[model samples]
Every structure is written in structure tokens, then in C-alpha cells.
Target: MKLSAHVEKVPLIHPFHITGYTFTHNDLLVVKLQDGTHVGVGEALGVYYKHDTPYTMLEQVEALRPTLEHGITRKELLELLPPGGARHAIDAALWDLEAKQRDMPVWQLAGMEPPRPLLTTFTLGADEPEVMATEARGFEGVRAIKLKLTDDALNAERVRAVRAACPDAWMMIDANQGFTRETLASVLPAFVEARVAVVEQPFPVGKEDWLDGLDCPIPIALDESIQDHRDLGLAVGRAQVINIKLDKCGGLTEALILAHKAQEMGFKLMVGNMGGSSWSMAPGFVIGSLCTVVDLDGPIYLSADRTPAVSYHDGHIWCPETVWGGPVAA
Candidate 1:
């Protein structure tokens, strides 16, 4: 096997803002693993909060070229890398490679039923009340919208405006750890009134216990707080849903492990994206079959997507077998 990696810059259609960072482009790391007969490709946007840059991911993967060329199994690869983008890219490529090498789909290997088209949530970055409302209204045929929120007075106004704009759409908010105990409490009334389905990472990581005081009605979701299976213990009473991002949890290898454990503990599952082209979103698309909420809208935010890419229609995302995991599209 041969290991190769490079950086691919994907411009975002609009500025993407969360708690403390804004993205205008995705500097992704694309990795390829090959055995003379076939080649497999994978991509990762890297985790922004943890500073997992493309170059860093590249260096991390490159350092293991010797061992990778010697051919490493997915489970062994897990111990060689921590849960992040470097591992995510390689892990995904391996899945793709194995799927073709064995003439099987990644989902079948993962013990999942045939993949189905999934309803995905189109996300809107943080903006003014009216601006966000306009953005939400602009999404034709997209019935689920995930609103990016911040720690401020306007968070409530933002949700209220969007809810009014798309009254019948399913609404969810991801604070990206922007709220404090007080701020989350302050926004609870408007969130409830707006019929917001869930509030994600309302309080920053390590403050999972903040929900102890407020009898909040909207269910909370844990994103940044739970990176992998090891962190599942932190979500017991803090959140009702766990947003699994391949970039954060490494890739499908760890994601499947995390999802199973999260489900067994009674937490609803959500598969999300860090930000990349269809190559990155495809793996999560497979995970979507087992998830209650799917947020693989990364390609929707990009200026352009790869060929044979995943498609968005009506209110769902469809990935063909030629796009990603098992023969490409998982």
C-alpha cells in the first residue's frame, strides 16, 4: 500500500461563524491510499477549535508513511493516531480501499442495511435577526435548518426571526459552546417559544453540569464535549443527543463505535460535518442511517463540489455508490 496526502482549498459560499471563529474557506486535507490495482481517497476539514490544520494533519499522516505502506488495519490505525482529522482521512481511505478490494460496500462491512436517502439539515451561520431569517427563507426545499448561534442577546432574536421565516421547518440550534449557564437560561424562553427542537452545546465543554439548575424544556445536544467513545460518560445527564462529527471522532471507525455506545446509553444520535466536500460528507451519510438527525450539509455550503458527489433533493441528501465509502458512497 502507498500513502499520499495533499491540501485542497474549498471556498465557502457564505461566511460561516460559530462561537469564536469564522470560516471563508475550508483548507482540507485529502489523503489517498493505494495498492497497485485500486486507489481510495478521503478528506477532512480538520477540527477548528483544536487547531487541527491541514498542514498539521498532513505532517501527522506523513510521519506514518512507513507503517502505512506496510499496510495497517483500521483497528491498529486507531492506536497510531488520536481522534482527529489525520486519523479521519486515513481511516476513511482505508474503508474505501477495503470496500473495493473486497468488492463490498462500506455499510455492509459495518453491518448496516442498504443505505437510504436521508433528510439533512441545512445550516445558517450566525448573523443578524433579519439576515439569518432571509438565509433560512432562501433555502428552498430544505425542511430542516440548523442555526449557528453565539453567546449574546441576539441569539434569541436570531432563532425567533428564523422560526418566523420558516414556520413549518424543523429548527435546531448549535451554539458551538457559546453560552454560559446564565445566557442559556436567558435564551430558553425564546427558544421554547420559537419551537426550537434542540439546543446544542449551549454551555462550553467541561461545563456539562451547568444544566443542573435550569429546568430547560428544549433538549440539549453534546457536540464539542464528546469527541469519542471515551467521552460518553460526560453526556449522561447533560444532553439528550450527541452530534458526531467524523473530523472530531477520527472517522467512521470511531464514529460507529461512539454511535453504538451513545445509542445504548439512550442518547439520540446525530451525524454532522466539520466542513469539506462530498468525500468528507459521504461517510457521515452512512452513519445517517442510524442517526435521528443528519447534518451532512458541508457540500451545500461550498462554492463547488467534487464530481459524482452527493446530491441534495427536496429535503434529503442522496449519495450514489460511486461517491464515497463502499465503492465510494457509503
Candidate 2:
């Protein structure tokens, strides 16, 4: 097998803002593995909050050159790389390579039922309340809208602005580990008042315990708090929703098992992304089929997407097998 990867800096249409970060472009790690005549590709945007950059992700993948060249399986990969973007890119490439080798699709390999178009949430970055409201209105009645929020006192006002702009669209918010116990409490009423569907990562990662006995009506979803399946135990009594991101869990291999086990453990599932290109969102789209909430809109943020891309249509994200993890590579 021949392993090669590069950093592709894809510019974003707009500067993307969350609680602790701002991005003008996504520096993606695109990994390609060649076995015989077949080539497989995977894209990854490393976890930003962890200070993961394309160079760091590339270094991690390069460190596993010997193992990958010698041929590694997804299950074996779990033992090798701790969960993060490097492992995710490699694992996804391996899955794609194996799928092509077997002349089948990844969903079939995973024994999942055939996938269909799923309603995916479009995100509005943290901005002036009116700016967010304007962006929310631009979605033109999107089925779901996910808002980026901060710890500021104006969070409730931001929620209300978007709600007023798109009264019919279902709403969710992600503070991206921005809030404290006190600020969260102050904002909880606004979330409920605006009828926000879920409040994601409102409190910082280690502050999940603050949720204990807090009277909140909105479902609390965990993002930064839950990485791979091993972290599920932390959310058992703390959060109602578990968000799975490929970059955090390793890749589709772990994400599939994580989602299944999370569901069995009685948590609502969410599949999210790290703002890679459409290729990065492809694998997540498969997991999205099983999730109650989907936020795989990374490609839409990109200034340009690769050919055979995952597309958004009719307020849904559609990933054709040709986009990834099939006999034909994207």
C-alpha cells in the first residue's frame, strides 16, 4: 500500500465563529491510501479546541506510515491511535480502500440498512443578533437551524432574534464550551422561551456536573465532553444527547459502534462535523441516518467543494455512495 496525504486550505465563504474560535478557512488533512490499483481518500479537520492543525494531523498520520503500509484494519487502528483527526482520516481511507477491494459500499459492509436523505441542520455562527437573524432568514425555511453562541449575556437576545426571524424553523444552540454554571443558568430560560430544541455544550467540558439537579427543560447535548464511546459514561446522568464527531471518535468505525451503544444506553444521538470539505462530511452522513439531529453542513461553509460531493437539497443532506466509501472514490 502507498500512503500519501496533504494539507488543503479551503477558504470559507464567511468567517465561521463559535464560542472560543474563529475560522476563515478550513485547513483540511486529505489522506489517500493506494492498494493495488485502487485509491481511497479521506478528509479531516482536526479538533480546533484541542489546537489541532493540519500539520499536526499530518504528522500523526505520517507516524503510522509503517503500520498503514504494512496494511492496517479499522479494528486494529483503534488500538494504535487514540481518538482524533489523524486516526479518523486513516480509518476512513482504510474503509474506502476495503470497500473498493470488496466491490461494495461501506454501509453494506457495516451491515446497516440502506441510507436515505436526512434532514440536516444548517448552522449560524455567533454574530451580532441581527446578523444571525438575517442569516437564519436566508435559509428560507430550513427544517432545522443550529446557532453558535457565547457566554455573553446577550445569548438570549441572539436566540430570540433568530427565532423572530425564522419562527417556523426548529432551533438548537451550541456554546462550544463557552459558558459557566452561572451564565448557563442565566441563559436557560431564554432557550426554553425561544423553544430551542437542544442546548449543546452550553457549559465548558469539565463543568458537565453543574447540570446535576439543574432545572432545565431543553435537552442538554454533549459535544466536547464526549469524544469516543469510552466517554459515554460521563454523560450517563448529565446530558440527554450525545454528539458524535468523526474527528473526535477516530472515524466511522468507532462512530458506528458509538452511536449504536449510545442509543442502546438511551441517549438521543447527534452526528456533527469539524468543518472539513464535503469529503469530510461524507462518512458522517452515513452516521446521520441513525441520528435524531444531524449537523453535517461543513461543505456548505467551504468556498468550493470537490466533485462527487455530498449535496444539500430540500433541507436534507444527501450522500451518494459515489461521494465516498464505495467501489468508486469521490
Candidate 3:
């Protein structure tokens, strides 16, 4: 087998601002693995928050070239690298390569049911209340909307504006670890009143224990707080849901394990993304089959998508038949 990677800086349709930072373009690391005539592809967005960059991923992949060339298995890859963007890219590529070799979809290889079109939540980045409201109005027919909030004074105002504009839409809030304890306490009631279904990572990562005895009307979903299976125990009594991102947890293998573990511990599951084109979102879509809330809208944020892109319509994303994991056509 042979491995190679390159970074593609694709522009976003708009400046995407969350709680911590803004993205004008997504710097994606595209990894390719080849065995004779067959080629497999994977994508990763090594964002600064995770301390991953395309160069870092490339170095990691290059370091493991010997093992990869000697033909490493998915399980072995998990131990070969720690969880993050680098492992995610190689793991996804291995899955793709295996699927191509077997002439089947990756879901089948993973013993999962066939992928189905799932309703996904579109995101409204942190912005002015009116700006968020306008964006919400544009997605009037979307079934669910995920609002990005911050520790700003107008956090409630932004939620209210979106709720008013799309009164019937199911709303979820992602603070991206922006709120302080005091702010979180103050915002809880407003969130419940606005009919927000879930509040994600309101408190910073290290402050997860703060939720231990606090009464939160709406469920809190942890993103940064929960990385792998080890963190599941820490969130048991605190958060009701865990947002699983393939990039954060490394790859689909660990994600599957974490999802099952989270389920066993009586927690609802959500599958999110790190923002890229369809190549980046394909794996998340496969994992979305087992999740309660699916937020695989990364491709929708891009100015353009990869060829044979995953199909999305009416707020639902269809599994790609042309690439990655899905049942092959007869």
C-alpha cells in the first residue's frame, strides 16, 4: 500500500463563526491510500482547537508509513495513533480501501444496517440576533436548527430571534465551551422557555463537574468534554447527551465503541462534524444511523462540494452510493 496527503483550503459560503473562533476557509487534509490499481480516499479538518493541522496529520501519516505499507488493520491503527484528525484520516481511508476490496459498503463491513436518509440540523453561527433570525427564516422548512451562542450579553436574544423566526423548528444550542457558570445558570431558564431541545457544551471542558447537582430543564450535550470512552464515566450524572465527532474521537471504530458505551450508560447520542465537504461528512453519516440527533451538515457550509457528493435535500442527507460506506447498487 502507498499513502499520500495534501491540504485543500476551500472557502466557506460565509464566514463561519462559532463561540471560540471564525473560519473564512476550511483547511482540509485529504488522504489517499493506494494498493495496486485500487485507490481509497478520506478527509480531515485539523482545526486549531484540536491542535491538529494538515502538516501535523501528514507528519503522523508519514511516521506510520512503514506500518501502513506493511498493511495495518483498522484495530491496529487505533493503537498506532492517539485519537485526533490524523488517525481519523487513515482509519477512514482503510475502511474505504477494505470496502473497495470487498466490493461492498463500509457499513456492511462494520455490521451496521444499511444507511438511510436522515434529517440533519442546519447551523446558525453566532452572530447578531437579527442576523441569526434572518438565517433561521431562510431555512424555514428545516426540521431542526442548531444555534451557535457565546458568553455574549445577547445570547438569549439570539435564541429568541431564531425561535421566533422558525417557531416550529426543533432548536439545539452549541455554546462551544464559551459560557461561565454564572452565565449558564442565567441562560438555562431562557433556553427552556425558548423550547431549545438541547444545550451543548455551555460550560467549558474542565468545568463539566459543575453540572453534577445543578438542575437543567433541557438536556445538556457535551462536545469538548467527551473525547473517548474514558470521558463517558465523567459525564454520566451530568450530561444527558454526548456529541460524537469522528475527528475528535479519531475515527469510526472508536466512535462506534463510544456510541455503544454511551448507550449502555443511558445517554442519548449525537453525531457531529468538523466542517468540510462530503468526503469529510460521509463517515459521520454512517455513524448517524445510530445517533438520536444528526448534525452532519459540514458539506452544506462549503462553497462547493466534492464530486459524487453526498446528496442532501429537505434537510435530509442521503447516503452516498458513489463513495465510502453505503449499500452497493445491484
Candidate 4:
């Protein structure tokens, strides 16, 4: 086996702004593994909030190259690194490589059902109420829209605008840890009025206890608060959904475990991304099959994607047959 890695800066169709940061481009670390004539690829976007960058991921991958080249099993790989972008890249590549080696898809290898087209939520980044409404109006055939919000005075106004623009679409909100207890309390009425189905990470991580006994109109999802299985207890009664991102919890390997545990605990599942191109979204598409709400729109935000990209239609994304982990003819 051989190991190599490189970086690619993927430009976004529009500027993406969350709580404290804005992104015009995503710097991704792409890893490749080769064994004779067969090759597998994976991508990781080590975003700043996660305390990781493309450079750090590349360094981590290079440091593990010796053990990887010499040969390492997937089980061993998990123990070799902690959960994060670097592990996600290597783990995804291993899954791809193993699937190709067996002449089967990664889904089959993982005992998962075949992939199907899923309705993905298009994102409306934080902006003026009118601008967000205009953006919402611009999208056609969208079934769900995820609205990014801040603790600003216009939070309710933004949701109202989007809901007015896309009256028929399901609305979700993500505060990205931008809200406080008081702010969230003040916004609950508006969320109920706007018919927002889900609200993600309204308050910062440590402040999750603020929701311990409070009645929330919509299902509150924990993103930053839940990293892996260990954080499951933190959201037991506080949040109704857990947003699983491969980059945050390592990769598909750990994500599957987290998903199962989340289900066992009676928590709804949501698979999301940190934002990247198609390569970064491929593994997430598989995870989406096991989720209730799918948000694999990372590639949709990119200006360009790899050839033979994941297909999108009527707000639903179809996993490309040519990409990693396929339902190839048996």
C-alpha cells in the first residue's frame, strides 16, 4: 500500500457565515491510498472552529504514512488516531479501498442498506431578512431549508422572512452556539410561529443544561455539544436530535457507532457536514441513509466539484455510481 495527500481550496457559490466566522473557500486535505492497480480517495475539511486546518491534517496524515504504508487494519487504524479530520480521511479511504478490493460497495461491506436519493436541506446563511428571503425564493423545488441565525435582534425576522418566501418548505434553524438562554427564550415564540421543525445548537455547548427542563417548541439538536458516543449522555433529555458530522466524530466508522447509540437512547438522527466538495460529501451520503434528516448539501455550496459528481434533483441528492462506495453490479 502507498499513501499520499494534497490540498484543494474549494470556492463556495456564496459566502457562508455562521456564528463567528465566514467562509469563502474550503481548504480541504485530500488523501489517497493505492495498492497495486487499485486506488481509493477521501477528503477532509478541517475547519477553524474544530481547531483543525488543512495543514494540520496533512501533517497528521504524513506522520501516519509509515504505519499506513507498512499496512494497518481498519480496527488498528481507529486506535492509532483520535477522532477528527485526519482519522476521517484515512478511515474513509480504507473503507473505499476495502470495498474495491472485495469488488463490493462500502455499504454492503458495512452491512448497510443500498443508498437512495434523499431530500437534502439547502442552507440560507445568516444575512439580512430580505436577502435571506430572496435567496430562499431563488431556490426551486426545495423541500427543506436550514436557516443560520445569530443572537442578533433580527433572528426572528430572518426566520419569518424565509418562512414567508418558502411557505411550503420545511424550515430548520441553526444558531451555531450563537444564542444565550435569554435569547433562545425570547425566540421560542417566533420559532413556533414560523413553524420551524428543528433548532440546532441554539445555546453554546457547556450551557446545554439550560435546556434540561425547559420546554422547547421544536426539537433541539445538539451539534457542537455531541462529538462522539461519550457525549451522548449530555443530550439525553436536553436535545431531541444529534447532528452527526464525520469530520467531528472521526469518520463513517465512529459515526455509525454514534448513530446506533443515539438511536438506542431514543434520539433522532441527523447527518450533516462542515462544508466541502463532493469528495467530502460521499461518505456523509451513506450516513444519511441511517438518519432521519439529511443535510449533505456541502457540495451544493461549492463552486465546482470533482468529475462525475453526486447528482441533485428537486432538492434530493443521488449518490453517484462512480464515487466511493457503490451498489455496483454484483
Whose lDDT is greatest here?
1
Q: How much is the lDDT of residue 265 in candidate 1? A: 98
Residue 103 displacement (Å), model 3: 1.0
lDDT of each: 0.90, 0.89, 0.86, 0.88
Residue pairs with backbone atoms closer than 3 Å in model 1 (clashes): 106-326, 324-328, 324-329, 325-328
* lDDT per residue as tens, model 3, 69-168: 8898889988889888888999888888878777888888888998889989999999999999998888735889999998789998998999999888
lDDT, model 4, position 298: 86
Give the per-residue lDDT digits (tens) of candidate 1, residues 145-253.
9999987779888998999999999989998888887788788889988899988888888888887755888888899999999999988877899999999999999
Error of 4 at 56 (Å): 0.5
Runs in model 3 lying further than 4 Å from the true structure: 326-330
Q: What are the per-residue Cα lDDT tens digits for candidate 4 across 1-330?
A: 999999888789889878898889889999989998778788998646778888898999999999999988878877998888999999988888887777888878888888889999999899999999999998778999999997689999999999999999988999999988889889889999999999999888788788888778689999999988889999977988999999988889999999999999999999999988787888999889988899988887788888878878998988875777653344
Number of clashing pairs per prediction, in order: 4, 0, 0, 0
* Range of the 10 consecutive residues with the lowest summed lDDT in candidate 2: 321-330
